[model samples]
Target chain A: MENASVPSVDNIRFDGSARTRWRLGFDRVIGWLLPLLFLVAILPILSLVYYVSARALPTLSWTVLTSTSPYRTDALGVPIIGTFEVMLLATLLAVLFGLFGGIATAEFLSDRVAGWVRMSANLLVGTPSIIIGYFGYFTFVLYFGWGLSYIAGVFTLSFFMTPYVFRTADLAFTSVPRHIREAALGSGAKPSQYILKVGTPIAFPQILTGVFLAMAIGVGETAPIVLTTQPGVLVPQTVYSPVTFLTQLIWENFAQSQSSGLQVLAFQAAFLIMVVVIALNIVVRLISSRYRKRLEGLYA
Target chain B: MRWLRWVAALPALAPAAILIGILVALVGATSFTNFGWGFFGFHWDPPTDQWGIMVFLIGSFLTAVPALVFSMLIGIGIAVASATYLPGYLTRILDPFVDLLAGIPSVVYGIWAFVIVAPVFGSVLEPWLVMHVAFIPGFGPPTRTDGLGVLISIFILTLMALPITTLLIRDALRSVPRDLWESGLALGATRWEVVRRVAIPYGRRGIFSAAFLGFGRAFGETVAVAMVLGAATNLPKNVYDTGNTVAAQMFELLDSAIGGTGSPQILAALAEMALVLLGISLVVNVLGRRLIASLYTEQVQGL
Candidate 1:
């Protein structure tokens, strides 16, 4: 194969001995510069991890993770609980709404309808999370008089997350083998049966990918909740009532100039949010990798 | 059968309708109350009801446009250099860095800017520019105090955008068949000359799509901008001066509004949101249409 490909390399010719050598040297330098720039670009990320970890790690104990802090400065229990609550509520809403929405768009919508949905999905995905928070604030807080309630926070988060699920589910559903759908219909299986029994199982892994991505995005989201959620030190006793999550607790504390208690708690909250984000990322990677391996096994 | 098909489509239509309804309501709240041109003037006051988004609009442009320009130049150059010139080992090392950059959150970028880039700009770039280039026209006195406000915002935004831009350009260049490069070489063209004439022109549309997407990302960026912007609502006097974008302004306005003082200001901020939504919608539609058209045209040409 090497001998056969000799003609291919011979087709191109470099004439100037000195000029070519200089060009080669220049190209080598440019090549090195590209990687160096990439390293510089990521320095910010490395430093953030380092800064947060250095400050929060000594105080981060199992008790801190498991229990809500009674003192303002020492514990992150309430914020952790609030974080899990918000994530759980948001994920449930996203999965339910996104699954049905995705199916309808993929399978049954007219071209115009699908086009419009696709456009909306892209708009939602593209629009900054801050804008969505503003929308929630206006709609839920001002007009509806819900104030800084969990319902508003969940709604804002779910609104932002829905697009991820919609896109993923739509792709997964579309990827279902055409022959299987046809065969199901040929065998007189009802449309609902085809979707629930045949369509869902095959697309389960991809749907999981969508759910994981939505969870990851939702858990890290702060700007939207800045307006919708109450920024208090103590977590609210109930989800229906106004509640402060870990990030909000941090924001509140950090903003206050003289409140050392709030400052320390805020730092702790920031660290927890980072940890949650990192954990979510790892889970997503594991799930996706496992799914890919399963796919390869089936194909092979 | 037709009726059943329409019934089957109702689930999709419902969510679409909800999304459209919310968008319409937001637009109406922001625009229709004052006949839809509320964001044009310069009257943003918290105490009074008067509001305008002139400064925020300018801030968005100032921060996003420069970052977009810088990232495009650097990212596309890097993509080409890596794909066409680099050794395999270097590419492998660089790939993970790009992926990691893309994966990191925008807020993290903001923190990084505050911690790292701000001091660097204040100490290094400010002094160096003052010594070398300050006397030039348009280059003003170098006052470097807590420089994370605008310049660092731009730096962070550029880093956020770089990964996607580089990846898109790299993919585009890779699709330029090896035969094209060989043919160019056959004509005694230098590697750079071949790339300039052949690869760039072939990948122009893809490059535009990548750049347009980056523009959209930067334009709508909030968390990163908000974190490092110092929340200064002033119009930036220079690149180094602090400012806020439409998104950041919305965040600030909403935070204050939720504290329960200014209802009309909140309305005014909503007006800013409407403007941002309109601007984003227009950009996305235009870019999306162009991208689809080019893709189809490419398909037809290939066929």
Candidate 2:
């Protein structure tokens, strides 16, 4: 905790040639203390997983996924389908558009403009999810007359995720060797072909990493999607209809008291979200690790 | 080929439009504010059409700043531990935990805080703090009966911000040259001295910026803090009192503003709050980035 314990000149001068016993003792204590802090930092993940599982396991059956609660049958299917549908559509929008955004940042803009754009995107990344959701609500729901609907949700989540996606992809493209870009251009290929065949293939892993990262964020995201696509018990049959999502289910259940069946349903939903989110995160971890290894190989 | 880059630029330019759209909407909404600059005043009576956001801003400050301090305490430990104290293998095991923690959604934290942590804080800690620490200005009973309070929000925010701050600080500490550490020890300084005298100072700028970014994260955090903030209506008088944040108020205002139940004034007021929150987030994050980027580049190149 006391990170800035600057050793004064006097202490350093005296300890310069002396192997002080207490100094070693203090070192031993810190060696124990730090890892303990690490443990404390790691404790929440362990307890959260344990707590949700223990609470929801009994009520969490295959049938639970088929129905939302005691009254709402076909319970989990709606959200599962809705979540995947929204995320797939959103991630697709973000990744495809994000690739174009990456090109702009990496290849198109002047250095100053690119830096500003990247920084703005970074600012947007940290902008509260709720704010983005409200923005979606104001712009699309109110301004565009989209209502609380599927396409609104997709756009909201994609915009929310786009900054991260484009950022990584942008960095990846910028790092693509200049020589390779020139070689592709010199080969008499059209610019589109050169970019698609040459730049895309090289930065594919990092781009994929960004896509997965965005998906991981999109999966557990509730606010923006919820604001745009207000939760319903059923999957939307139209682009302009309310649809359910796992995070919304959890948020609603915990926000207010519900029936015990609904309570159990909340935990089930939480447990499932945790699983999918962590799974997505692990996939990201795998992809990033592979990307790291590849980079290391290039350097090696 | 030249035009292809422009094609990519089109989508990249999209965010600018989004930002402008948001700004225009907020600017238009806020231009018609009923109370002028008094909208940011301390008293928050939304029902009375007084959308003073001083309390929500205070609520955000109280939760995030303390969480930053708490996360820094843990973060400095982990960063220094990995850099100079802990063995590589041990820190390696903790890496995935931090990574996964960084990826966790806010709602997961929100639910846990709501379901499990809030009750304990409400029943146990709130009364104890009110009784024993009543001398402290913020330490009072929960303003709402449900037991959620600023203290629980701080606790949860600390937990939520831990991983990112730790990772950020860890990156900085890891950048410290190993030679400096060994040289310190060669001078008969203990490992503790090597860390205290060498690694930390070297990465202090990064560590500071990291902590600042963590504060930004906590400030912008909506769901988790809202879940534990207790009473959205009350202007909290004590640490354990119920409160609201700008982001939380924004969320709460959404339904009423959209459902045609609330007047346009409410939406307008909420827009002002969003503008305030957005401004704060930008300043904090931009300042933090500037700190991390360092202003010494020109000087370094002998400019």
Candidate 3:
């Protein structure tokens, strides 16, 4: 097999004087192929961005942004509101829980407990988002009788979001110098006060990045919403009423080959979602990269 | 203040507890269902109440396995290029775009597949494929499922897996010591030769973990697969045939199972399906984590 492609090392001169056709071919193939493949790999994503934006140009308007369409299916207003409501609620819960949960794991929990928390978080994060939705369906929808309500979606999204926040916060809190905590304690600050006054402020930037990342993830998530939120034509009356999402509109409406109008709405929704999701991710990468560099500078 | 100290742990603890409870509930819900070898048989007709998970299992793997292979090839290429071949400025721009791909929801991918890809395939690509490679198994005649089939599902999944696998593998490649490559190149080896001989061998574990992670994502993905896969409950005859994955089938079947038919048996069966998905994902995720941890340990030890 090796002989078919190229010569063995022993066959070649030890000096760099000789270069065979096979060797040159192998070098050129790899030299060109990897970069070309990388370009091909990103084509779909680039095309998605291009396609949605171009298609959305006709349907996007001030009217579309402000109010629901007269057709029940083509409306963007309610789904957009539902999307923000669920994301904001979930983010708030996730941040609150994640901050303390992370603090506890990094600062207060015993090694065994910390290990357990880390393991669980890892497992939960690894679990498919759909399963998380199914889990929400089982607990909140079935057991609690919430049916497809905002609270259920919020809880489920928060459940999914918490692990990410926890991991980021844990990393952030752990990076706080041990001496700072000691100094705070020695200054007669209580543990809570020390954590709040010293550790949290130090970790806030990184934690905020995590929160934003989670928000992006939750905002775009469709599975949990599919299972837990009531898929309705109307905007949600309250947190308890069933809500529509932009993703749901895209999924349910885009496949409608019958109506060009619904398809256009779906395309516009997709474009909007792409914008928001990409924006959040860029924010995350920017903040996190700068935060990492700052930490490196501090350590250095 | 003391109460607050303990309360801070609740948010983290609650999710962990919920995850565990979900697992237990899945088992408990499905415990009453009979899962003999026959249950794994490929007879999934819900009307007669004879539901076996084999078809969906095959569908999921049939799409996911090939998609994983495709993604690995592209992902490895991207990873290699990003770490070694690409200019730093290009890599900087490309990295965020790849992340943006990952961040985009699957539902959008589904819409893209249905709206843009399906028509394109039907009008142009599928006809060409059929003419050129009709003998091949996956390149057969396209069925009448609005052009949504396993092939499209595989394509969408490949796109979904690419960014995840690329990012993981790029990190793995980046972590390889510069000295290893320098030493190999110092021995009069070409850049490709140095990368193949030094960086890849050192980062093999991370690469494997990346593949596993991609596999995990592909296998359990829902919305995109649901929209593109045609949601048929039968075994696919070829890649062009309509098929349904476990998650897709569950999503479609759950409502009917819950409200329309309102049968406990079907609900239990759906629960069993969820259990299987849960189990496979958990195992794959744990393995991926282990591989990552091992690679980290190796790097720390200066290996």
Candidate 4:
């Protein structure tokens, strides 16, 4: 028994040490607290969702969704359409620029130049939205005399959003497998062909996600649009004409009256805008996650 | 074919070019000013030639500092709880909500603050604060609406800043090597102790950088802050008092400027404000980069 190689069961049994007990107690308390903390942290979102939905959901209807607010009586159709128009146009421009710039930054530029590009993008992203608004006013409205035009608004928004798209496209391009590029080049494919056929297709999902995010950003913007696009009741007759947007509707409505009817309409406008923005964000998340998973699968 | 690469680069370069052009124009606009101390004075009435920016400056700091402090404390807690203390399944559910919060537009947050939070503060929160802690500099007599004030701005800014701060800190905490956690557990350290003594210390650089970034975000945020803040151009007597901010005042400036009521001086003053905003953000970013640089020479993982 004394010379046995194997330990006895009792000797090998776990001990409830004081340190272990304290650690367990700590873990238990933390486990209980974690959910509570999360709830507190998420209070703003929950509150916004709750308040916006409860007040606004009832007000949204086919009537409100179909008619223009030429009389300013609470219809949201024109503003909603305008929002989509600006968002789509801005995102399209941003994505096109992003694709070209991202490819150039990632594939053609030197590392130092690429770093500069990234730094500038970060700086632009950090600049206040209002500052961008001011800049847009200074250039398009004042200097160029574009005078409250859709083209001006679109350009301002595209400038604001292109950085995100550029960064995403750059990242996507950078992440493309070296072998694929080498193989394409080795097979004597033209650089342009390789980029258009191989590089862009591989990175399309990420690039698209950036475009969606940019659209969300564009849809939500008030300051730039307010600065560049003069407010009008009618739909814009030309690219040079004034425009109105959903966010501006919300802003103008709330400021105009404390009346319950106006408040409801304002809330409704907010609600609709939120739905679109959140939907775009969800698409971004889904695409990025799917892309990540596919990458992981390929590597694994 | 080589020219094609440079041509492709132009799109990316355009934004940067535009940014530089804005700076150059701003500098040119402001070149006429004496660059005197009066420019930073309290008054901002352009017609009277009283075009100081001190009130807005103070208001900006007042709104941002508290929000930064609040977000940091709450954000650190959230990061710790979600990344280290909480179960994986819980994180899977909560993380998306946080991201959604981040994705909510600044305009929407403004609307929420204006319509929902402002009234709640006016009716419930402000009265309680005045009753309990009126002695504090930030607490004072409540206005009728109580929505357009520094406190409301702080509240909204804190909420707006939370997701970014939390995500950054979470990334920081997660960057710590697994072996450290294993070692801490092996040596009879509690999970909290491991996070407190090891994980936080190890990731302090990232956390500090995150703090600076979050502060920068609050500092430069527009629309939301402008909406909630009443944009009165005065030094705030208390948090409840309506205070002006640079971003908020920029809107007014633009309006007047666009109305053609503004002189070249007024336009230059607006330009100067823009430059100030650009300078502050630049400094904050540089400070953030320097913080990360001083800690380690390795590339900081995320922006």
Better of 2 and 3 by lDDT: 3
What lDDT is obtained when candidate 1 is compared to the true structure? 0.68
Q: How many steric clashes does model 3 contain?
A: 0
Quote the lDDT for A206 in model 4: 77
Off by over 4 Å in 4: A1-27, B29-31, B140-145, B289-303
For model 3, the stretches where C-alpha displacement exceeds 4 angstroms are A1-21, A68-73, A177-190, A254-257, B1-12, B142-146, B255-259, B294-303
Comparing 2 and 4 on DockQ, the stronger one:
2
Q: Model 4 - which docking category? A: acceptable
Q: Which residue pairs in model 4 clash with each other?
A: none
Best prediction by TM-score? 4
Tens digits of per-residue lDDT for model 2 on A1-300?
123322322333344334565666677788778878877667888878888888788767786676545356426878888888898899988887677887777877888887777777767776778878878877788789999898898888888888778777787888788888888889897766877898888888877777877888888887887677778766788899887888887777765565676667777778888888788777876776787688678754
Q: Model 1: per-residue lDDT, tens digit, B64-161?
A: 88888888887787777666655556666565556556655565455446555678888888667667776764346645566756777888888877
The CA lDDT of each predicted structure is 0.68, 0.74, 0.77, 0.77
Cα RMSD for candidate 3? 5.0
For model 4, the local distance difference test gives 0.77
DockQ of each: 0.32, 0.43, 0.40, 0.36
Interface RMSD of predicted model 3 = 6.8
**Pairwise TM-score winner, candidates 1 and 2:** 2
Instruction: List, residue by residue over A179-224, the lDDT tens digit for candidate 4.
Output: 9999998999887888889998888887787678777777887888
What CAPRI grade goes to candidate 1? acceptable
lDDT of 4 by residue, B197-263 (tens): 9989998977887788788889988888878888788798877888878888887667666666767
Q: Candidate 2 docking: what grade?
A: acceptable
Most accurate candidate by DockQ: 2
